[model samples]
Structures are given as C-alpha cells and as structure tokens.
Target: MSGLPAYSLPCQSERATLVSALLLLLSWLATPALAQDLGTNGPTYAIAEPHLLRDLQHRLQAKQASGELDTLMARSRERAIASVRDPQPIEGVAATRTPRTFYYDPTFTLDRNVLDAQGQLLFAAGTRLNPLDVVSLSSHLLFFDGRDSRQRDQARRLIAHYEGRVKPILVAGAYLDLMQAWRRPVYFDQHGRLTRQFGVTQVPALVSQDGARLRIDELETTQ
Candidate 1:
C-alpha cells in the first residue's frame, strides 16, 4: 500500500542501464593495454556501499592495488555493490533427487504445461482457489518501484542479499482487468474454468499453495 521507490532514471531505463553504459565507455577508453593488465574482464568498478558513483570510486581506490585493480574485485564484484561468487567445486558431493513440485504464477512463466490435463491452471477467472494448495511467499518477496529513495536503497541491499542464492526473475504484471495497461502482453488469462475456480481478480498475484490449500495471494511489499 505504500508507494514504490522511484527509479533515478526513466522507468524505460534498464535496472543498471546507466552503469552498463558507463562500463562500455570505460572499456573502450581503456582497452587492449589496460585490458590486458586488468584481465579479460578489465579492471571492473561497481557502485558500492552508498550505491553512488562517488562511493564506488572510493571503494575502487581502497580495493585497487597500486595501479592494478584487485583481481577478484575487478571480475565479479566490480561496479556491483554485490559480489558474485564462483560456484565452489563440489569435492565428493553427490546430487540428491527430490520430487518435482509445481511452482506457478499465471502472471509469470511456468515450465512445460502450466495447465493440468484437465485444462485448469488454477481455476476459471471468476472461481476462487481452494484453501489447500497455495502457499503465500509474498512475505519473502521484494518490490522495486524506483520512486522512493528508501526503496531504491532497499533494492540495492536486496539484490546483494540474493546475489547467487537464487536467481532473480524480473517480469511485469498487471491487475487482470488492467492487463492492457502493460507495455507488453500479459503472461496468462484466467478465463478458463480453472482460473474461474480460483477467483483471481488481481494482477501480479503469486500463488504457491500446496494441494490442500490453494488460494489467490499477493506478495508482501519489502520496501
């Protein structure tokens, strides 16, 4: 219910579009000679701490060794407030198998068939989901509106926090009724019996209920 954070640039701008552009320029200006000294990725720099250019420059200086940037910092965490870790080589660890569970959002992507053989994804648009099959993960979700300074800061922290534990899936959704307002097509339509059965009425709803407790759910805001 609170306002989403305002992004510093136009909403049309990429999440790190500005930074990417800068990197491209820097890469060009310091190519070949510096690039070799810096490694294949070059001496990387990332916004850090305060999430601003100045802060990033400060961190870069502190992190740089002489005229050479730190190898680790330059490659993975460069210019990113967060550091991306290389996957640890598993020594003798064996993979374990688990039962496949369905994770779905009508507004999001689902693998293979989101619908069952019965042709129901959840319920017909007008129908309400049964209480048994859904688990609300909204409390665990974060939103980035890019309007509020606080949310912008939070977004940075959130991105860093989930750096590699889970890959982030970015998609846009709208209230089912306002699907047309989206710049692109909505992911799914709840017009069938299944959608009706779930009684879905909102856009951007994420339902992760179990078989016994299906229901429409909204993500809790993490601003």
Candidate 2:
C-alpha cells in the first residue's frame, strides 16, 4: 500500500477470471476446426456386395464349356488313387511321445449355452468337462505341408491304412475343393490349431494316441 499502485484485490481476481474465461472460449472455438481437419484427413470406407451365385454359375458354365472340369476331376481322381497305391513305409526322422493329460475349463457362465445346428441345446452353460470325459473324443491328426507330392502321397497312404479306424485330418494343404474332388472324406486344418498345439514343424507327420500319451512321428519322403 505504501510503494505499489492502489489496486483492489477483488478487481484483480475478476481480471484473472475474465482471462481464464477468454482462454476457455478460444479453446472451444478451435475444437470444431480441429475436428474438420481430422475428418478431411481420415480415410473413407465403402461396403462391398458380391453376387456369389451369379459368379459361381458363370465359372461353372465356362469350365463346362471348356471341358476343364472333367479334366480336373479326372486328374483329381488319379491323384487320389495314386496316394493310396504303393504304400511306402514312412522313414522316421524323430519320434516324440508326450502325455495327453490336459484338462478343459468352462469358459462361459451359466447364462451362456451351446446349441446345435437345429437350435437344440448341446450343452448347458457352466457345464465342466474333465480329462476322462473327453478322452474318447480324441482324434488322430495327420500333418503335412501339402505342397510336396511325396508328402501328399504318404498322407493319402496313411489315410487309407487308417480308414474307418481313425478320423484323418489334413494340415497345411492345398485347396479344400481340390481335396474334395479327390473323393476323400478328409478334413482340412483351416486355422493351424493342430500344428500349433502339437508343435509340429515338419511335413508328413503323424500324431496318434499311445495309451495315455500322444506319439508324434516325423517322417521323411524316400527318393
């Protein structure tokens, strides 16, 4: 009060408040411009609609007219037959046997339930499955790269050998349509689940249950 200019404390507080209000107003005014810039810079996307039936019919007609379908079917049949013939004993590079004692936990709550194709309840929610409850449902899986003719042939032979005795699954193969054309009732591993679960890194590998353990055998194609 003695040396400084005479200023009211309330007046200074009002000035500070006014400055803060102005800054807030300026920030609010800039928000719309910032949003417009982002909108202009962002990517745009469009939905795609495909005519599957029309395309399939066109392809079928073209193949039928060109006589390629018959040729493909014949080649596929020959390959299927070749796979089963001249069964060469698999030459093993290594054999691994591991215990298959894995347990399954219910991932869903009681409110969630599993249904069948006909909307029938397959399993109620909160249903837990033990290791013994799923032992009989285990399947023998066959792993192969499918690009190699030798491996395909070996896989086919193995399928033929275990026909009716085991369910054969194809891993890392060519198109499923091509396999179906061969008239083999084999299933393809679309997601690489079996390969990843079993740590299979080699082609022409066979996985079968040995007592309470899984026996994984990696085989080589003989020249």
Candidate 3:
C-alpha cells in the first residue's frame, strides 16, 4: 500500500505474465493518437501510461527477486576466407582455429557508422571470413557486457584465451546504466529468438560460428 496503490495485486510469480497481459490490454485500449505517439516517441511515451507504470514496477520486483539481469548473451565468431570451388567453405586450417571478433556497443553512437573517427566501418554482423585471412581481424575485438563479476570474468577469460590469436578484448559490460539498460541490445533480443539460437538463458555464454556451423559455449559459475 505504501509503495503501490492497494489494488488487486497478483502473486509475485505472475509478475512477468501479468505485466505482459496488462501491456496487451493497454495497447487494445490505446487511442490511435496515443499509438501514433508511441511509434514516434518510442518507450519514453509508453512509460507514462498507467498500466505500463504498474507493469514496470512489477518487472523491477521480478528482476530483483530473480537476481541480476542474469541472461546469457549470443557469442559467435567466424573467420573470412577465399575459395574457388567451395565458396564459403567450412573446411580450412586457420578458419578452424581462429575466430573473428567484434567490438560492439549497442549504446555506442558514432558520428557516422560503427566505424572509428578515422572513418572505418565496423564489421557487419554475419560477415564472412576465410581461414587464411584470420590475421586480417587481429586488430579487431568483440564487445560484450561486463557489469556482473561472473560475466566480466567469463568475457575476460575468453578474450585472454583468444588473445594473440585475436586482438585485445574490449569489455562493454561496464558501461551499462539505467538509461542505456533498455537500449542494451544483446546479441539476442527479448522473446528468445537469438537467445534460443544460442540456447542462452544464463549469463556468460560464448558464441562461435564457422562458415558451415555455429557453436555456443557457456561459462560455469564458481561456487
């Protein structure tokens, strides 16, 4: 009653479900003008909605109870190669050993594209790589969340393991804050698309892809 209005409160277990349902109702009840505003203004407008506020509060409680935003990220790595007969061939020596790395930040707003101030574009997702050409990406790195100790450690270890074989790892997890939290787009999105692709339901998952196949590796938390 003190924190929230005394209404028909559901059990804690039902928070996400309830929140989801409330959102649906809110959408159904929303005026065309309000819906248009939502499309233009994005989530900022949605936050002020009565039902959205309540749903957000419930979601906060759920997040706290569930521990940190403990979810696995999509980890994928691949090498670029050239071939005559077998285009995008999966069989190669360096390709089998070396993995292409990415240094990404969903929050990063470049004056231009993902490229640096010097004017170089970042590697596009799903870029093709060859085994012998792995050295080309040696100066590049991958960006991932590093806020949690568990996640940081796992990411660090992965980078170290791949160092020399790759560039110095860039940890972007430390930069996560409330404003950018929602904007924090992981390799996966909500509703479990890429999350399912990588089977990521926990923190510290690694993803690697060969020209022919994809592989995901998760870190084990230490007790």
Candidate 4:
C-alpha cells in the first residue's frame, strides 16, 4: 500500500510469487551453462559392416557365381509347374473308403443388392433364389483323385455310363495329364471349392442334379 498505488496493488501473495519467479529467472540467466559431455563409457569404432542391400547383393553374387542361384530358380520353376499341374490335395478329402449319399440345396439368400451392368437393381437384398431355376447343371460332376488308378478307372466308367454327360473334376493329381488322356476338359476343383460348396468331403464323388437339389454320392472303391 505504501510502495504501490492502491489501484495498482494486487494481492500480496500474488505479487510475492511474481517477484520470486522473476528472481528465479534472473538467477537462471546469470548461471553458467551446465551441459556436460560424459564421453562414451566403452570403446567405439566406425561402422565396418556393409549396408543391408549391399550385403544382400554380395551374397546374391556369391550364390550366382556358385550356380546356387540357378539351382534355386530351377527348383522354384519346378514347384510352380508342379503347383499348376498338380495342386496340393485337399485336406481331409481321401479316397472314398465309406459309401455315402447326400444332397445339396443350391438355394441362397442375397445379402446385398445384385445390380446389372447398367447399375439397375436386378435382385433386391434379402431376396431368396435358386440357381437351378435359371440354369441347371449341364453335366454331372465326377470328383475323384486322378493319382489313384482305381478312382481314375471309376471316373472313366462313370463318364461312359453317363454317356459322356459327366464332367470329370479332379480333387487332386495332374488334371492336364488326365485331360490329355481322357481327351476332354478334365476340371480340377481348385482348393476343393466345388466339393466344399456341395459338402463333399471325400473322393470318387458323383454330383448330379436331382431336380432343384444336387445329389452327391461318395462311393467306396477297392484299392
């Protein structure tokens, strides 16, 4: 009150705090720089290792010089050919050891609106439909393992019995070789898609249209 005008005087506590902060700031500014450089505790050396890309390139060069790269490439090419010629057999699907017959209803409900090329809604969402109503299975599907002679023979017999109305579909083994041998378009069920769709879990299975539903007959054959 005595030092400052009554209107200019703020609270004593706030004024003291402000003065203290200014003093602390001045003290800090008056103090010398305190940054210390504690040198490395252990020995240090320049990086001797090559860059990752350079190292990889060197290793690749070494492999190429040894003809290892060529071998790896050839092996990769063989694997690729093998995969296309004979894809990995579907797991849990074995040669028909147990005879079983089942039916699959091809009816499905639309989860979303199906549109035509013009973006016009062809079928609204939640609509139930059967594919058989529009187009029936043109040929009966004969699913079997081409690797087994018995199954191949069975497929051939079935194809002949069906009067060449059967489409030989392979669950495993070389499809191209079978196609050439059978002189027809031998289809391979890539990843057992058709089998899973039809609920077929075994080989030597015959799939035929039984009206609106598909009849799957998993037959047992001798070794």
Candidate 5:
C-alpha cells in the first residue's frame, strides 16, 4: 500500500484461468499433428520418382550386360554338380530279406496241363519242383545322379566294363536330353522305391546280387 499498485483478486483469477485454457487448447491441437509427423498410423512412404525408376532400370541393364548374374549361376551349377558327384558312402549296411520255408506233398493231381506246339507237355499243372533246383535270376543295377558330369563319366566307364549289362537307374536327376544324347537306357527311381529296397544312401552306387542277398557299393568319383 506504500508505493505499489495491485490488481483485484477477481481480475487476477480471471487472467490465470484464461491462460490455462489457452495452453490446454494448444496441447490438444498439437497432439494429432505430432502423431501424423511421427507416423503412428503407418509409415508414410514416397513413391520412386520417374528419375529414380529410370536410374534403377539403367543399373539393372548394366549388371546384366556385365554377365555378373550369369557368372553366379554358373558357379551355383558347378557346386551343385560337384555335390552330386562326391557322395559319402554308408558302411556296414546290406540288403535285408525275410526268409520263409514251406513244405508240401511232392505228388498232386493236375487241374489242367499245358502242351507245346509239338504236343510235348511243357509244364504239368500242380507239378511241384524242388526249390533247391530253382535258379534265381540276378543282375547289376547301377544307381547314379545323372546331373553330374563326373558321375556320368564313371557310369559310362562302368557300363563299358560290364559291357552295358548294368542297368542305369537315375536317383536324383532329370536330364532326358542328355540321356538321349548319350544313347543310354536310363531309368528313374520312381519315388525312391529302388533306393529303399537296396538300402542305397549315396549316388553312383552299384547294386549286385551276392549269393542270396544284394551287395551295394557306393563309389567315389574323381574330378
């Protein structure tokens, strides 16, 4: 009260209330703008401008012309071919079989008889022959991955050694053109039936009959 001037309490209170309302309104309006800037809805992306697209196309053309992609493909093919050729062999595995023995009367009446052109009885019906006298037909079935060059060469050499008596079974390759070009009778595994039957785990394998069972040899190929 000595030399200072003071506002009324009502006036002061009104000014403070007005300032608080202005701050709240400003904050509410700024919330949405800040959210948009921070990309809360999702990232705001700019499309590649015309010049940028042209630049990318030009770079792609340059790479193709430099044969970089071709070189990579060739290397990939070579690695795949090498992997097929040099397969690891499993040890101490042999073809398994179930043995069954049955006996029947040696004498039986024939339901019908078969005769040859010369009126000779070729086989009489119900004629039982001795099992010991039966001969089992056996052959060599060579398994190979025909995609690899080394395996194919090894197969060719083996076929020549066996005088083409080896039956070529392709386990994991489909090169019909190459088969035709090489003039080889190549057969497919057809859902891996032969591989399972002979217990073959590797490529360039040789399956042959050994007495009553089969012997599987997984061959290693050189470069």
Candidate 6:
C-alpha cells in the first residue's frame, strides 16, 4: 500500500480508444491462423550432422599431442607472472629533487545517486562529498620508486621512522620481489591510479591525513 500512489483514471475519449484497441486485440487472438499449402518446394535428405563438442575434443587432443597447448599455457602463465612482478611504472612521477610540501583536499563530486538497501537515496547525484568526513587515512602512504636503490633505502628508513605506520607503495619495479624481501605487503600503484588520485609527482613522498585534508611531503632522499 505504501509503494507508490495510484494512477488517475483515463478520460472518456481515452477510455473509448482503449476499448477499441482491446476489441481489436481480442478479435486477432480469437481468429485462427491461416496457411496456404505449398508442397514440393525442395528435395529432402536424411540428417547427417557432426557433434560440435566431439570436434572440439578431437582438436584439443591433437593440440595436446603436439605440445602446443602446453606451450600456450606456459606463455600465458609467464605473461601473468611478469605483469604482477613488474607492472608499468606510473608516468609523470619521479625522484624528489627538492623537498616540497603541499596539501590535497579529498573532495569529489558524485556522478550517480548513492542508495541504501531500501532504495532510499543516501546521497543525491552531483553532490560534492569529502571522503575525509566519512573515514580518515589508516596510515601514511610512502610512494617511492622501487627500482632506485636510494629510494628503496629511503622507504625503509621512512617505515622505521613511522614505526610501521607507513605503507610502501611502489611506482616502478617488481612489487612481488619487495613483498618477499620485506615480509609484508608491498603495494603497487597499478597503472598510476593512486598516484594520479593523490596528485603525487615525486618519490619519497609521504601522504598523511591532516584533519580534513591530506598533507603530502615530497622529501629528497639522502645519498
């Protein structure tokens, strides 16, 4: 009863048009279908068909015998591992030459309405919202190129200085290798999404939540 309001009744002319449409539809449904007898159109033959699955299975078997399937599988696995081990570096980001500090306001505009379980609108479309209002950063993000030895050392120093309250995010080089060596989670920007979002353009940068804003410190690493 509380779902939606009832629609208003149609006018006299609308009612008459609706009745005429209904009558025509009923007449069409009640009438039987007609077909003209057109015999001897083409020559008939017995069904002779090959099973699709069987053909596919035979092709697979041939591929397996020739070791082509294994080679393809190996190549696919290698490509997957290579992508994870060494992803494309974040563009327009590099080592910090000069120590600079800036703040980023984490305000974003919603493109679509956010709804709850009951379909009630929580936030309307085009509403500008600051994410810091909802949740604060758990820890400081330390972005450094893993390929550079000095930057890697700088990241280690930062992690120790922050007492493990800093996340090491790699913008370049193998993240899996670092994860294995560090014995903790080493995150990669994965196509520069995080760097782009944070507007980070330099390495040895520390991102920490400063009240309602994010404070980014791009520090130069010591030799």
Highest lDDT: which candidate? 6
Clashes of each: 49, 0, 17, 0, 0, 0
As a whole number from 0 to 100, the lDDT of residue 205 in candidate 5 is 79
What lDDT tens digits, residue by residue, belong to model 6 across residues 50-93?
A: 79666555655666688765565566569888988899888999
Q: What value does the lDDT take at residue 103 in candidate 4?
A: 95
Pairwise lDDT winner, candidates 3 and 6: 6
Q: How much does each candidate deviate from the true structure in C-alpha RMSD?
A: 23.2, 25.8, 20.3, 23.4, 27.9, 19.4
Look at candidate 6 and tell me the lDDT of residue 158: 82
Ranked by lDDT from best down, the candidates are 6, 4, 5, 2, 3, 1
User: What residue pairs clash in candidate 6, if any at all?
Assistant: none
Tell me the tens digit of each residue's lDDT in model 3 across 106-170: 22223433455886777554444444233222322322334445544554465568762322121
Candidate 1 per-residue lDDT, tens place, 113-148, comes to 346688878443445443223444332222222223
* lDDT for each candidate structure: 0.37, 0.56, 0.38, 0.82, 0.61, 0.84
- Which candidate, 3 or 5, has the higher TM-score? 5
Q: Candidate 4 lDDT, tens digit per residue, 119-214?
A: 999999999999999999999888888899998888888889889999998888999998898789998888778888888888899888999999
Question: Least lDDT summed over 10 consecutive residues: which range in candidate 3?
Answer: 72-81
Candidate 3: deviation at residue 160, Å?
A: 2.4
TM-score of each: 0.18, 0.39, 0.26, 0.73, 0.40, 0.67
**How does candidate 5 score on lDDT?**
0.61
Top-TM-score structure, candidate number: 4
The CA-based lDDT of model 2 is what?
Answer: 0.56
Per-residue CA lDDT of candidate 2, range 1-223, in tens?
Answer: 5887886566887677445444443443456653334444567778586696564556555765787655655665687775553222223312223323332232224557879999999879887544433564366667665556676677667767877454455554443544566675666554566666666655566777665446676666533
Candidate 4's TM-score reads 0.73
Clashes of 5: 0
